[model samples]
Every structure is written in C-alpha cells, then in structure tokens.
Target: MNDLFAPRIAADPSGWNPHLAAVLADLATTDAVIAAQLSKWAHGWGAPFSLGSVPLSAVYATHVAPWNPPEVTLMTAKTILWIATVDDWAERDDAAPRGLDHLQEVAEGKAPDPHSALAGALADIRDTVLGAASSRRRGSLWVKATTALLAGMKFEHVASAQIRDGGPPPALPLYLHHAGQTIGVPLTMATLWASAPQPACDSSLARLQPPLESASQAIRMANDLQSYERERRTGDLNAIALGASPAYLRTQIADQVRHCLEQLRPLLTHPCPDAQALHYCLHFVLRLHQAGDAGHLHEREQQQQEH
Candidate 1:
C-alpha cells in the first residue's frame, strides 16, 4: 500500500514525516481499492445512490490515521454529508470524528500548535493539488473551510517566523456543527452533524428504507433464499444497532429510516449526478454497515462478483 500510493518526495521522502507518509499511502490504496471494487459493484447491481462515499471514506482513512489537517477539513465536510444523508442520524454522529479545538488552533497558526500543524498540512495539500490557487482562495466547501480557518488565526511574532521557517499555517474560525456543539476542524460525529444543513423530515425519512426493508425481509429471504441471511446481515445489523433507542424512539426512528430508504432506493436505479455523488452514498452505507455489522455487505458483493 505504501509503495502503491506513496508520493515521491524529491529527497528523503520517506524520512520526511515517514510515519505520516506511510499512513497516507495506506489510505490512498485502501480508498482506491474500495472505490474500484464498489464502482464495479454499482454497475453490476445497477443501483445508484451516493456510493461515492466509499472513495470518500477511503479519502478519510488517509486523513484520520496521521491526523493531517487539510484532510481533516475534508473529512469533516464528508461527515457533514454523511450525517445529513443517513437514517439513524444520531448513530452516524457517534461513529464519526469529534471536536474542532485542533482546527481553531490551526487557524491561530502558532508553532508546535496541533492546529497549526494541521493547517499547514492542508496548505501543502492545497498547493500540491490545486497549486497556488489554494493561497487565500475559497473554492469548494473544503476550500472555504480552509480559507476561513486560515483567516481567523492570531499568530505571535515568534510563531509567525516559524511559519516562515516552514511550519503549519494559522487556524481559522471554521465551525462544523454536530450534536448541538459548534466545533472547529470537526473530527467527531457531533461536529460533523453540526456542520450539516438541517434535514427536512421528508429527506430524513427517505433515508431509512434500505435498512428497514432489508432487515424486515431478512428472515423470510433467508428461508426462501438460503444466501439471504448471510447477504443481508450487514444491513440488518446496522439497522438494529442504530435503531437501539427507547422503544418509542426506536419505532419512530425505524419508521423514518425505512421511509427514507424507500424514497431513495428508487434513485439508486437512476443515474447519479456523477461519480462523486455515487461515491458519497456508497461510502455512507458501507461505513454504517462496516461499523454496525461486520464487512458482510462488502464481502457478499465481492463473493457475487467472483462467482
């Protein structure tokens, strides 16, 4: 994985934050492999919701491993989307990253500041990927978050020189809301939800269908179709785990998740806006499935392909 996605450094590449680089390389491979596999699966199933989330998750695996700041911002944005789109929204929040204290520090741009380190990495990433256009420019939500973060920091003179001496950039005031908290550089589930726009009831309920229906049919499907239990276990586990609240709450939540899934399931048959959107959807479902169940959803898909 390291060899596969490792970026070539001009000199002493591996030595330059070797640990971080190794992690990044692993993430690149993981994401790429998952994305490639999922892409083939989507085509075969002719199902198109936001499968793009798989690649985005792969993208996130890179950010979380070594705590890259720019990647953190990207991860936060993705989390925001995930919480907004998934049923059992609260459960999604719990599974995602938390807190923005680091982001605030990044905005501040002080030396040895975790925030600064993160901010600098982001700056470097932007420069590498988007060129100088990353300098004080806001393009996408991620870019905007970066820009806002950079603009909000207060640097001491000593820290300022360190930045000149090749350190991380200052922090920003970017706040991603989650779990009723407004945090900077959100890496948590709460913060991720905090950053997302409020979902209307209709939208929220539509997301619940796949898991609900899949769960409901699991036993019957298993008896009628021997492979059904194994194949559907992932979705069932996710639904049950996420729906575990007070009895009344579970009922309400299950209803909503089922409803949402029903509404959106049809969209899976239609063309997605693009690969990114598809990837987003795929990533969310996979994550929920992975976190709540085992990797059965992905595994079953793979088995189907091999056969």
Candidate 2:
C-alpha cells in the first residue's frame, strides 16, 4: 500500500492536459528542488508507483479549472500535492494505514513541523489561493472540510485492528455509511478552494454539503468496483469485501449520482464557484467510473507481469 495512493479516478486521457504536462515537465527541476526540501513525494509524480498516473494535483486541477491560466493550474496542483502528501503519511498501521493524528494537529491550528517542506508547501498553497477576506470567511469551513475524512480513516483503523485480532470486519450497512470518506473527502472539495477567490465560494460549499457527500460515496464505490479483487486478496476493507453483491454497489452508486445531479442542477443555474467545481467533480468522476476506473496503472502493470 505504500506504493499506492488515493484519488486514482483521474486515469481517463480525456482529462489529460498535454500543455499542462509540458509545463509540469518544464518545472521538473523546480519540483525536484521542492521534493528534496520536503523529502516526500506524491503518487503520479516522484513516487514509486507513478508510472502511468500523474499526481492527483496535476490531473485534478486540469479537470477542475482547465479554463484557468497556467498560474492557477500550477497553484491548484500544489494544493492537491499538499493534500496527497499529508494523506500519504497519515497512516498509523500498515494494514489500512491511514489516520488523522497529524492532520488533526493541523486542524487544531498547530503549526506543522517548522522545518518541514510540506508545511511550507501548504502555506504557499493557501496564501496563493486564499485571499484575506475569503480566508476569513472560509477559515472554519476550510478546517471542517479539510478534516472531513478523519472519522472515516479512524474508523478504518479500528476496524483493521479488530480484523487483525481475528475479529470480523465491520458489517456491510455500517461500513457503507462511512466508506465514502475512507479516501479523503476533502479531495472532492479541494478544487473549490482552488477556484477563483469569491466570497460566494464559502457559502457555496455550505449549501453543497449534501451533494458533496453523495459524490464521495459514489467515488468510493467506484473504487470498490475497481479494487474489489485486490482488496479481497489483501484483506482490506471493501464494500464487497465479504463477497457482498456487486449489483448492490452499482445500484447505490447510481442512486448517489442521481442525488448529486438533482441537488447540483439547481446550483448550476446560479453563479457559485464551489458549486461549479463540485459539478465538475461529480460529472468527471461519474463518467470516469462508468467507463471504468483505470487510475491504478501499477495494478495493470502487475497484472501484465503475472500473465
């Protein structure tokens, strides 16, 4: 699991930005320097499993604000990098090793390690994207949204511990409720924070909480579908880990999609930046999953070798 990471839904080439790729290529030296200072890397970038997947930061920014200028593209990518970096290290145990301890400290407003490059990157991302007025308005909400995945990860940790001790995995109904957040709900909303600085973006997030949950659930289920066999073999938590009905997961995913569209359609008529960003997220992810999630390119590589 060290080699793998989350937000693996952006594998579709339709979301690829060749010029952006070139820009990232051009900035390779700069990224290398930053990576050196941080001493950490992200999937789809400098990490071990980056072969076929670009960092979520790059690919997700392209999908979120493709119309933005290059500068915004880079800024959003950095924020996404920060998200994935913290996510990568949040694990406490090797079996489903993701927790909220470090992020919890941040959520409580404790400064990260003073010399850590991740802290610097996070500050740069926030200062670059969040303006004074918008920051003031969105501070609490940002904290709330940023740590949204904590509970889900903590639950998984406990569940993993129980399973490790020969206890049963969590029940299907209970697991389904928190499953969506297992991969970090904030990733879905990071694009909103990346969106143009508008005070409306703050309230826009509040209004869209329902749809955001739906989107998270939908994405997690898509992951379940794609990683079911891998998870079954590895004894990881999965919707159908106990051999539950894939058809049931499909039906729930469809329901979530409907809920997202139904709730988002009304917001689209208005000019809410966060709503627009979420709309893009839901649309892109649904299309990607419907077509099939291919972001775990390393998995494909392993499969080919096995064959």
Candidate 3:
C-alpha cells in the first residue's frame, strides 16, 4: 500500500503537497472486510458499470479509510458505490429527475418503494447510515445532506440540458454552488461525522462550517481541473468548460486548495478531535486531487480505454 503514495515527481504536479502525501501514506491501508463488502455490494446492486469503470479501491483508500474504521469504511464504500451507480445512470439517460424524486421521498422519512435500482440503493444507504449514526442529530443532518445532494443533481441535470440544447453554461458562482452539492461533499462529510467515534472534541457541525465549505470548494475545483478533458469529450458540464483556459483553471484550483488548507490550519492546532478529523478528511480529498488521480467514473473509463 505504500506504493499508493509514491511521489509522482516526474509530473511535478502543481497540486502536490508533502503533508498531504504523508497523510495518504498513513491511511492507505484498508480492512479486508471493506474490500469484500465493496465487491459483494457492487455486484448485488447490479452496478457492474462501477466495477468496470470507477477506481473504487483507489477512491476508498484515499477518501474513506482515513476517517473511518473497517465497519464504517465498508458502509461508506457502499454509499459511494451507490452514488457512483446513480451518477452513471444520470449521465447516460434522462432518469435523474425521477431518481432524485425517489431519493427526496426517502430522505424526507417516507418509506415508499424505490422506483429504480439507483433509488433502491439510495434508500438502503440511508437506512444503513442512520442506523450507524452516533446521534439522532447527526442522522438528521445526513438526511438533509442527502436531500441537498438530490437537489444538486437535479440542478446539474437542468444545467446539462440547457447546454445540450445549445445554451451557454451557467456562470461560475452558480456552477460551483450546484457542483459542490452534486459532488456530494456535504453528504460524505455528514456520513463521516455520523459514524465518527463518540464525543469528538468540538463536535458541533456549526463550528466546522467554514472549513467544510473551503474544502468542498477545493475538491470541486480540483475535480474540474482533473476531469476537464473527459467532460469536453462527453459534452458534460464542468466548471472548466465554462470557457476558461487550462492554465487559468489550474491557478484557481491551487488558490482554492490553499484557502482550504489555511482554514484547516487553525482547526488542526485547536486540540479538537472532531475538528482534526474534519481537517484530515478535507486534506485527504485535497491531496487525492493534487495527485491528479481524482476523476469522474466516465473519465476513468476513458483512461482505461486509451490504455
């Protein structure tokens, strides 16, 4: 697993951070149960597209393992797989609105039968995560985040349709707001907070808001940078596709990540375990993108095909 963090110095990637590399080295190892459960659930959920396309192990090792134990990692993996499955479906067809409706109903506490496999997977993830939450407040926050993610997805679908119909892309601020939620950073954070060890220092979500937003923005920009080519190829919506040069986009991404790290620095020095955990989560995501390994499910497929 050490190879996972081996410096790609040959690239001299503008995003590389030594501290982030150290974090990756420390947390790259995953429990066998996580791997096994990921495989089992991927198959059972009828999400062969995820197995064939997305870099699931890489995503888990980088994003989920650092903040969670084996059981939580497994649960997080299931949720991620479900999200990826839904994203793939959304990209391929016009079913996203219906899917989002089903998810919204589930997130609102209704127990209606899911209308599709994607919806069913979301319902299952909601139940599993709520059952594992350390407190009712955290569970409630998770539901709200899920609903927010659905809304974001709906927004993306609308934006994509507009572009597909020959309209110009949305302005940068509007795109980032929608993209942040569509990227599911808030939902992922809620899950991490929910399953985190009991009584974490400075556990109030309010306290972590600024850093979360900063980190999420960084992740969103990094994703745009890393996946720009693939998005262009697929006629997909990306922040970079909003008419910016690659050089300009890279600069914005670097600035965004720097801001996130600055926000995290004070929290890390504050002796709060929850704040520290949130810091770790944000840093992990930042470094994953810095490594230039962060991309959408379809982007990974494109890489596979090219190779």
Candidate 4:
C-alpha cells in the first residue's frame, strides 16, 4: 500500500471554530482570496479523481439542514472532511500550482498509484468522521461506499455487499446532526472571513455573499412551502366539510399545483452543477413544481366560473 493510501489520523477532535473570525476578517478585506485558497488546496490534494466529484458547493449550500434520509447526513460529513483536509493548504499565497496540473502533482505523490491513494484518503476520512468502533463500522461502510461513488470511484462489489448485509440504517453523527441546526452560520462566517471588507470588484462582495443572500431566500422559501402545505390541508378540510365529491377531489388536485411552485422556487435560486444534477434526478418533483402553478390557475378559473 502506498503511504498516501495509509489512513493517517487527523486531529480535529473538538472541531473548534476559533479560526472563523480571523477567516471572516481577512475575507472582508479581499474577495477572490478565499476562492483562490480553495483552488490552491484542490491542486495540492492532487489530480482530480472521482473524489472531486463530491459536490462541495452543494454540500456548503444545503447540508446544514436536517436531512430526512440519514445518508444525506453522512454525505455532508464526508464532504466537509475532504474540504477541511484541503482548505488549509489552499489558503497559502505561495501555493503556485493551479487547476488540473496541481491535482495531478498531488495525485502523483503516492508510491503505488493516485487512484488507490485517493481511495485510502477517502476511507480514512470516513473512519475519522464516523468514529472507529465495530458497532459503527456498518454506518461507516455505507458512507464510504456512497462517498466513493460521489467522488467518481467505482466499488460495485463493496456496495453490493453492503446492501446484502444491511438491516436498519445507522444514526448520523451528533455533530453532523447539529450542523444542520446551525446550518448557515459557518458558511456565512467563512464567506465573511474570506472576503475583503471593502468592495473587491465594482459591486460589493458582501452583497454577493451566499450565506447572507441565500440563507434568507432559503428560509423564506421554506416558510412559503410550509404555508402552502397548511393552506392545502385547510382546503382539504373545507372540501371535506362540503363533502368529497368530484369537485372536492379536483380542488385538492389544484391545491397541489400551487404547492409545487413554492417548493421549486427556492431550488432555482443559486443552482450549481450538483444541485442541477440532483434536480434532474428528481424529475417528477421538478415537473410538478413547473407545471403545477399553471394547472392550479386554470383549475381556479374553472371553479370560479362554475360557482
């Protein structure tokens, strides 16, 4: 096994945020600097392998929320682990190499091969974040399998083995679960830290901060969706009060159309490749969100004319 493939232990037990304020302070002064830092680190981590396929940007965007499916929780944890590993190295001004060249260099550092080295790093990250215990191994396995695929690795045999052995899914780590509760805080702080205080370009960098701009948008959309759902329930209740006739069923269907729009608007706000990819995967949901509104309006017109 290559030294690079060896799972060296990383020290982040407390997972402290002491550097947050400093990062934000620096970013308030410079706009492109943090992005530059990320790019640099990506280079050092080595040639873009399948692991680079993990959508760090989307992870940053939505991973902070409570995931109904616990797999999402693990996915976020693994992605953050990768980011933490590379980000510190990326921040240095002296790191000259950029893009694919830098990644290739980093990948070539291993004795055996780049692919296996990356696989080991990924496996190490899973063990680190999930904890090292026999009880947790199953959960760790699931995360490792999913993360490897996301990063662009193929481990079909391992994945099939996991499915065969699976019974109940494991609980996500406590920190990752809580990370959703405090969703926008780190991202907001990070953006603030990385940006210059003054406007870096013609426009204010502060204005474009993802946390500042999108968090509120996300919250509002979430709220609107909730309200839409409540109203639909209320409409159903009213229909039941009137009696569940053909008209009542049609009314409930119309309600669904409006509810779908509320859901889709938030998703479209700041879409990236990962988000778009996920959206495509949820084609049925997307179709409902897109077509639902027009259908609702038409139904409303028909209902009004009949009345």
- Model number with the top TM-score: 3
Q: Residue 306 deviation, candidate 1, in Å?
A: 36
At residue 264, give the lDDT of candidate 3. Answer: 68
Model 1: per-residue Cα lDDT over 175-293, one tens digit each: 11111121122222222222222232223323433432333232111121222254244221211222222343334434533553555555556432211232233333323433322
Return the lDDT, model 1, position 223: 21
lDDT of 4 by residue, 108-217 (tens): 33222344334445444344334432233334333433332232211112222333476322222321222222222232222212211111221322232332223322
Q: What is the TM-score (0 to 1) of candidate 3?
A: 0.80
What lDDT score is found at residue 165 in candidate 3? 93
Q: What is the lDDT of residue 241 in candidate 4?
A: 23
Q: What TM-score does structure 2 among the candidates reach?
A: 0.72
Better of 1 and 3 by TM-score: 3
What are the runs in model 4 whose C-alpha is more than 4 Å off? 1-40, 49-63, 66-117, 132-138, 144-307
lDDT, candidates in the order shown: 0.33, 0.59, 0.67, 0.32
Model 3 poorest ten-residue lDDT run: 1-10
Q: What is the lDDT of residue 243 in candidate 2?
A: 56
> Top lDDT: which candidate number?
3
lDDT score for residue 50 of model 1: 47
Better of 3 and 4 by lDDT: 3
TM-score of each model, paired residue for residue: 0.28, 0.72, 0.80, 0.23
Worst 10-residue lDDT window for candidate 4 reads: 193-202
Clashing residue pairs, candidate 2? 91-97
Candidate 2: stretches off by over 4 Å? 1-56, 69-72, 82-99, 114-135, 201-203, 290-294
